[model samples]
Target: YKLIIHTDTLIGLSFSGVHTWLEMYGCEWDDQTGAADAFDQFGYDGEDFVSLDLKELRWISPVQQGIPTVQKWNNDRAYLESDKNYFSTECIEWLQKYVQYGKSSLKKTVSPQVSLLQKSSSSPVTCHATGFYPSGVTISWQKNGQEHHEDVDLGELLPNEDGTFQKTSTITVTLDEWKKNKFSCVVEHQGKTKTENEIRTNPEGSVPIGIIVGALAAVVLLVIIGVAGYMVYQKKKGFKPVSGSDDGSNSSAHTVPQA
Candidate 1:
């Protein structure tokens, strides 16, 4: 029988003029034999700066700029030894408690809100899913219950201020396709519940409400202009109407004479 033991820690720091923002320490051992197989120190100094491979007794990614820092760290063995001592004595216990709290808190789930919208006839339909926990979520486009890949644009998962993740998937469809069938956006997350939004087809030859209203207004304006023009044309042709009786009595109706 074989068993293995592994421990690692990651720490991040931000300071003025400090390019080294992140660091990690990793060590692995064989449990049954009680012998370590690997111990490593890796860091990022504006990039992957350097790594100490204790198993090989060598350094990896020894950039010219980082060589001096590596040499200085290696020569000051006492400080490195002190760091390891602190991690084993004080950090491990606190890390374990934090891990336990994470596991318990993650058991609670939040459902995502799915929205399906289209910007215009020329644009694709956007499937936006937001406010979900545990970032490992799948958002996809489905056409009539089957997975669709063609003409689909997938967006990156972005973190929100509330610690939740949001993603969007868009699918290009012509006006005919949008009016002929239905499409859906499906979201699958860690929780048992799944959320989806269905976009139903619009009626054939249907236009947006704004466009419809504008067309009607145009027609009404044209009709008004045509009637006004006809009245002006009749007056220009020298057609005259008989005046009404001055008293409040019905007068004989008289038609304008033809020009």
Candidate 2:
């Protein structure tokens, strides 16, 4: 969100005044369902003065002081039609273009690393899941093999510096509750990677309770480093290594070229 600020004025011999107004308008686009929503609103003296209802193509005013302006603006059918058309079609197309341009990063899914943390034996246990993408995940606690919700406190989903997301869920249990029943934190996420220990038994796309994605990241890092190292060597020094995937797509991973 940003502040809406601008100035407009028509200087003529009949009138001389500054036309500074505070107003805001924007649109939201959903790529999954291809739906677009728009809003055009205005404020006056730090109050909700008027807004445009796109569906009705009419202006709405909360305060009585805005009634005259609303009634006058609502009567302009041509202006309303043009406003609706621009926001629904043109604005949405521009936003979709930007989304398409950033599809690789925006749509990429990175698996999370789940860990149970506690400051002391008596402290509440926090189930932390971090370094994930898309920000949609589930974290729950289980007691005696069943779902538990009584003492659970879910944390806010936060962004990481590398464009990933992290979340935490804490469960408070006493010594008696711990000794008598089995307590476990369950985290659910998609796009899980296969691991060596559980590869043979688990079926393809099986969602384990939790798995560290760093092993997979390490392997990818090594592959990228190898490719970058090969490119660093000039053709005169050695053979230039060609890196290509099965679909013939080359990764953008790179390092500083050798001097």
Candidate 3:
């Protein structure tokens, strides 16, 4: 058996077109076997305060165990028939109508797009799943079909701009393990079937995209150098050599001085 209770109060004031939000508080309790296993209260009355730590179940803030101030502010008996009311009775009615409309009109299910990516060859790999609805998801890493918890960093589900949700999980691996072992990212969503994304391992001595580009550049540079050297050699070989004397006999030119 389970029992849960939630209380929320919002205090807002508007003048003409401008509005001011003054105070807000939310409280939750679970009357677990009459012991109240989950009793916590948090709010901001011009200053943030919490009655008890939700996890530790102990007082951590200056505020002690007491009913939230918002409750007293909203109590019907606190307001007089002649006095101006702080809360808008019309707004409360509209809020209830909106809740009913959301329950029946909202689109609730959306499939997620799961992807596996790495920042670099040596960096940790991230498994990102995004564009899902309802925000209930489980992301984990598995090696050889066995789930791994150590070295895995799990992130919380965050809402997207388009009313969807996204989450990411990361795992560190040695370069040897990254290349030799098979690792997969498993994503489980409440609305969609389970999904898996396997890591693509590079073969031994295989060049990456960046390394391949560098090799091509090196080859181009070598080709340019070879072409330049060959041009220089051709120019040297094309030079006309001094021919032997026209008489075909080896001779030297001698100039005589006249008296």
Best-to-worst lDDT order: 2, 1, 3
Instruction: Find the 10 residues in a row with the least total lDDT in model 2.
Output: 250-259
Judged by whole-model lDDT over C-alpha atoms, candidate 2 comes out at 0.62
> RMSD of model 1, in Å?
33.2
Candidate 1 residue-wise lDDT, 1-259, digit = tens = 1111222233445665444434444334333564543333444554666665543344455567667766666665565554454334333333444455777878757777777756656667777777777778787777777888899998777655555667778888897986776677778877454545555344455533433444455566679789987876555322121224235343222111111
TM-score (C-alpha, index-matched) for candidate 3? 0.41
lDDT of 2 by residue, 195-257 (tens): 111111233344322223434444566797899877654332221112332242442211111
lDDT of 3: 0.52
Q: Is candidate 1 or candidate 2 better by TM-score?
A: 1
Off by over 4 Å in 1: 1-89, 104-108, 191-259
How does candidate 1 score on lDDT? Answer: 0.56
Ranking the candidates on TM-score from highest down gives 1, 2, 3
Window of ten residues with lowest summed lDDT in model 3: 250-259
Off by over 4 Å in 2: 1-14, 20-97, 191-259
